[model samples]
Target: MKFKNHILVGVLLMVNVFVFAQYGKQKKADILFNKFSFVKAANEYRELIENNYNKDYATRRLADCYAYLRDPRNAARYYKKAVEQVNVPIEYYYSYAQALRGIKDYKNSRIWLERFKDSGGVINANDFEKDVNFITSVFNAKQQYFLDKVRFNSKFSDFGAFEQNGKIYFASSRDEGVSVKRLYGWNEQPFLDVYVADVGTKRNVDHTAKLKGDVNSIYHDGPVTITKDGNTMYFSRNNIDEHGLSKDKKGISNMKIYRATLRDSIWTDIEDLSINHSEYSTQHPALNKDDSKLYFSSDWPGGFGGSDIYVVDIKADGTLGVPTNLGNVVNTKKSEGFPFINNEGTLFFSSDGHPGLGLLDIFGTIQGENDEFVDVINLGIPINSNKDDFSFSMNPNGITGYFASNRTGGRGDDDIYAYHRVPTLQVEGIVSDAINTKPIANSIITLFNDKEEQIAYMVTDENGFYQINIDRNQDYKIVGSQIKYIDDYRTFTSKYLQTELTTITANLLLNPVQDVIKLAELNTIYFDYDKHNIRKDAALELDKIVSLMQNDYPDMVIRIESHTDSRGELSYNDKLSIDRANSTYEYLISKGINPSRITEHEGFGERRLTNGCEDGAKCEEKDHQLNRRTQFIVVKME
Candidate 1:
């Protein structure tokens, strides 16, 4: 028994030593990270984690180190592990969510954000609001619904995928005939091509067509994106033509972005992006959803790394402006490439130099203030394996993702694969008059999500239709109303898994009231003198009155009254006021109001005066104008 006790003591001592060693390593890593020696810090933290000592703290630190090193995949892996093992602190959840966002997994990121919120985590709502990528992700989910898949395999190399119109575009070198190629001074096949397939049905490519371009010849053509209208195409091209090759005479083996015009559904007249230069290698061009900005990967001088992502504004005339570095938060000393910008403006890129799982893995971040990137996160595995898993693409909805890997098993050196993504929900509907089966144009619709947050509000179109997309697994309340009608309220619940068009139709009925009510609330009623023409201001006032009547007192009717000052004969003034009131009534009718509900004009020729100032009795021009105004009143409040 004494011997056993001694053995136990020895084991405890060894454990203590291990723990101390881990603690010492962590301290050193923290110091390194504090000093901005993120690479060194990541190494130390990785060592500690590998030794399985102080794993939770070590993993957390490791993740932080990786983030500082600009390696989000490894960072995310450790963060996920840390969260799973213990009650993850709010900070950890925030970090994890950020990592998920880095890879454009906004749905999961949102889930984590909610978790963070539930754990009493403090977040600046404004920060989230300005996060374009996050906002885009939210918008995508609310706009459409679909099941997503993350395809994996051990074969041909696959990289990034982009969706435009009803087609999927991606980059791959799987069909390379040569056994070896070279990229960025690395030995690899020189063959990379941009391929497209139909994305309307299941995630299947009917035929993989290579992008047509001389610049795409015998080099890498990848990381492609097209404009929203599919009129212009932008992509990365490595190793320029012999005429523009580098000084070394090796075909100027650096990458640059090229543009092409899509005419009659075919790409024509390929042109180099005006922003490209021979001195710096630029690749992986991605355009914002609005095509207002271009983001790309480069190793140009004045950058932070072997390759860093850069952005430039696309001017209205299709000219490119000076490129701006994405800043140190996203760029590191190591290479960062293969950037993909979702419709929401979240940035996804791949890096080897950052603290990551192995060589190269996908990472995510968002553009922050001063054009800096914040919340750098690593995508965790299966998405990121031990091997290099670079090149990522996502749909506009932010649920599904596609990336390239050389893991194993494929038709060639690399093969493209599709992935399943999370689902999102949106709400859309129409508003109309209860009496008429016609579309209600410009009916106000307000949507409040389950979080009791007013997500959006919009007016119906000429057809009285409105739409508000929201996240799944949430309850929503919609309030619809228009002028002269009672407000309509409806409720709905949506889940990601559900596939159905959710619609809300609200019909409002108005009750008949009196003719010629006072227009006390209106600011002005602009009109043409002596012409009885209602101006823009007059139209606006009529719209407001219509909205209140429709939404607040749907069952109530109203009357339009026109008044004239004593500047003219009583007969002339009465006729003018009557014409003006009728004109106002006609404008309302044109705006989709029920004509039957509106009573005829009640022209008062200088008979009523609130200021008691007669037109010829020292009345100011303002008073005369006020007396000549048009008024609307509820004839019936039902």
Candidate 2:
């Protein structure tokens, strides 16, 4: 009995020691996670979960670690286990939904999202569902962008690409060949520094160097923007002073924006912006088209998300106005940053809150009527993957640009990708007067779809040129109109567009409404040898006249003349011609054309034969058919 008791006590002591060791490890993992050291925390938590120590807590923490690392596969795996527990937090349901979305399992994502809603989640359930469906359809649509990884990407994180003055500026953590290497605990990479490289015509980079200035610091730096004049610049860096970084109560050093001036071809006069707060972050500076405003991302208090985009006006004396939040439209309930405003005033930024393919997708928005950014659209596909994609920058031309992504098949944790969008399918043309061929300035050009719904419109420039982007494989109608000239329309389809031919030119010529009558370019109205009643072919031709007079020239009046082939008797032919003219006029009236537009109807009975098929001349059926015709001549314009 004594020997058995001693063995049991020994077993208990060993189990206690194991439990204490697990407790210590769990504490360490928690500390690392709280400090944002997700890479190391993920390793620690994985071991704990594998050993079945504190399985519930460790599983959820592991899932969170993967989420923070932007690893959706592993995150979904552990989150699946975590939420299976009986008393899991409701927020985990929302997290699982987002993780499922990252893996493109949108059907299951919607299920969990609905569950999250039923469990009292604060998100808009309907909007998220609609966004999922909309984004899925867009992803299934034709791809419009092509991306290539730049050669200068380092083995470490290399991202946040910008371009100015023939050089590409980016942030990187590459420190090869340096005497001493400082590693960040978050991912064990070197501290980020601003780097620049000459950009080739094809966006290729063969060499890179640290930016030439005192702008780089031992801490995180870079992701910059320059003014149009190239004499001023703004960049982001960790909040620091001579005594080292300024930290909040939690010992986290947030980022701050700094302004620098160019002198002697190097950036100097580094000054931190007054808008930064020690308790929050303000980084990722961007300049508007005219340099009158500055945009950036921050985690400032009262923000709708972890980070929200804000804008500030630049006064004439180079001072900044009060910062204003971009509002809930552009800012979501999750992080939104890395703003880049193109010359056309379109705002492009990265967001994780919006329904997307994965972690952080690039979105574009245009200013709405209320001056708020609206119509946010995910860039979709090749620009975004199932990983973190951000820091989008595009030129004013809206085709070529660069973005950063940490997706698979990259050389580093994050890589800069050069992207070129396929040219937008567009139609362009000149509008001119029909008589003198002079360019018609300020003429309205309207575009309609197959449904006859107006989709877009623009006015001709001083050069009488107008261009409009259109969709592929769709039928469209373009109409040119001026006050003094009759409107002209051309219908065309974009079906089977040539791969190399992107632009469709459709010039329009408008006729002036003068004292004399004018004839519209219509297919000839035809009749049978002895028949005068309207035929299917004749009805089709008459519809054109009806449309031109009723829709294009509303106040115009017309006269109709009809004829019959010489094969018929002259008396019968004359009666038949009159019937043909009367039938044409009646069809127009039936189709809603004003009767006043047809002032007279007369029959000529083959008197005006168009060819030598007259009398006894031997001619083919097609030759004689030409003489059986009707003509619509505009009589008066008011």
Candidate 3:
């Protein structure tokens, strides 16, 4: 079927599958490789390598074989070798990073991903900042999910689950004898068919059987979304006509949505929905509360690109209204599909374009006041993986859900995993000016979990109040940032222990940036005669300046200027004064200030004196002391 995973993993199963070229003898491996039989491909490649047939080429192919086979350990080992070999493809480096992530070696994965990026040529998305931040926050935020591969999964691919009438219905590609004995050229898996089984236990599914109707065709029959009442259904199927299957201009068959009605335990009156297009594919249908709106993924004309989530009104007569693209916030130039709308109206979908760990990562977005998907949030890990993760479903209960993934440890190619949200502990507070206690509104407050990874970010309201949900019994860091003010950061733990700060009231303080820019008085450094070492009093004074620059005035630069009385040789005074300036500059460097921000420290020697106590000029000791002092110049500010 025409597919685009353009949206996610599901469509990739059919569309854009790469075919390996035929190599002369033992075309054996190429056949299996093209069939998506990674396991067999790896074995054959290993044999070829053992026979000493172009080890470098075989090794790279072998690594790719293992990568598709989902054996990350072996994939990582061989990919490491492949990346170092000559003529390695840019994609090989990305595959190496993905393999590393599959093995939970994320730090190393980051290293290889950087290498892949540095190797140039756009291997990953540019929008990775939010994804990186989200992954960091999940580093130690106690695993909230207890995942178990569903028992009903076939040895082949099985996913896209939904519940109705105490029976679980899902899509699978098990080669049941009754179906047509044809293998899909893309994956060599049997054509997908919808199956139903009695509601099984959490770990095991009861006996299963294919749906009895005109649903399963000789061609691709995939995911189905049914209404709450279970009478109406929208499913994906290869575009077929009375003359048989139809092909688009690309010589590829397209996918279309077929609606059916269930009557007396049998699905009947099947008909194509109006949202389909002959030029593009539309699949993965979903619905809102009253089923008045039908949502699905499509690559029809006028889309941003790939597939985008589109909603159409389900008219009273069961016809589709005009489809509206969810827009750039939810859809990107890349694929975004497999939409699941929860009861709360929040749209959950998977996309490769959004900031993500890798591949297709799940993102959540709700319609804002303007009725648009705004501020999409990556669902984080366990729900997401470096591999393709799509086809998410959350029950109306608001806690339990199911999602599909081909990550490291699945029972099948794409298994459905169950998830339940754990209770969350929340932190709420107000931010204000430290000195006057005035509310600091609209400040950005970031919360980092125990692992020092940011877990949540909030903007203070007009009242300076903010709240964020967090995991219980874990340590956290709250950092507040606002323009023209210092970052207000605090570290606190969320716990119920007697000694813990359970009744937290983090009314943060943000010192005005302008307050620190006036540094002349506070920036003075005094040195004993002929001594360039920083003194205790001077060291204490520098601490305040360092803190402000590091916390608030990040773009500010300072210069340390030293002057001296003309009591000694001109050259001696210049050298001594420069030494004093160097001593002060080094002090700030040791305190974590960037050397670039220090600009340059210079000494004018006796050329410019604060007092006339120079050469033969008579002056009191205080006059000489004034010229011995060091002063700071605000070289730049932002």
Against the true structure, whose lDDT is highest?
2
Model 1: CA > 4 A from native: 1-155, 174-190, 200-208, 212-215, 242-252, 367-371, 408-412, 423-638
Model 3 spans > 4 angstroms off: 1-144, 177-180, 201-208, 425-638
Q: In the order shown, what is each candidate's alpha-carbon RMSD?
A: 23.1, 25.9, 23.2
Off by over 4 Å in 2: 1-141, 201-208, 426-638
Writing each residue's lDDT as its tens digit, candidate 1 over 187-251 gives 45445667666664444331135665442555667767888888888877764665644433444
Residue 615 of candidate 2: its Cα lDDT? 83
Give the whole-model CA lDDT for all candidates, comma-separated: 0.64, 0.78, 0.72
Sort by lDDT, best first. Answer: 2, 3, 1
* Descending-TM-score candidate ranking: 2, 3, 1
* Poorest 10 consecutive residues by lDDT, candidate 1: 135-144
Q: RMSD of model 1, in Å?
A: 23.1
Candidate 2 lDDT by residue in tens digits, 1-638: 22433564466467546655765676677655543345677778888777666566678878876665555787789889988975576878878877787788888878887887889876653646553433233223457778854888878888889888788889988866777888988889999998888775433332237887878899999899999888898999999989998899999999999999989978889997888889999999999899999999999989998899999999999888999999887899999999999866668899999878899999876343344553466788889898999999986555678999999999888999998766446687778767435567789999999999999877875546666768879999999998888999999999887533457778999987654333545567888777777888788777777777777778776668888878767888788888888878778888997654565677888788898888898999998889889887654454
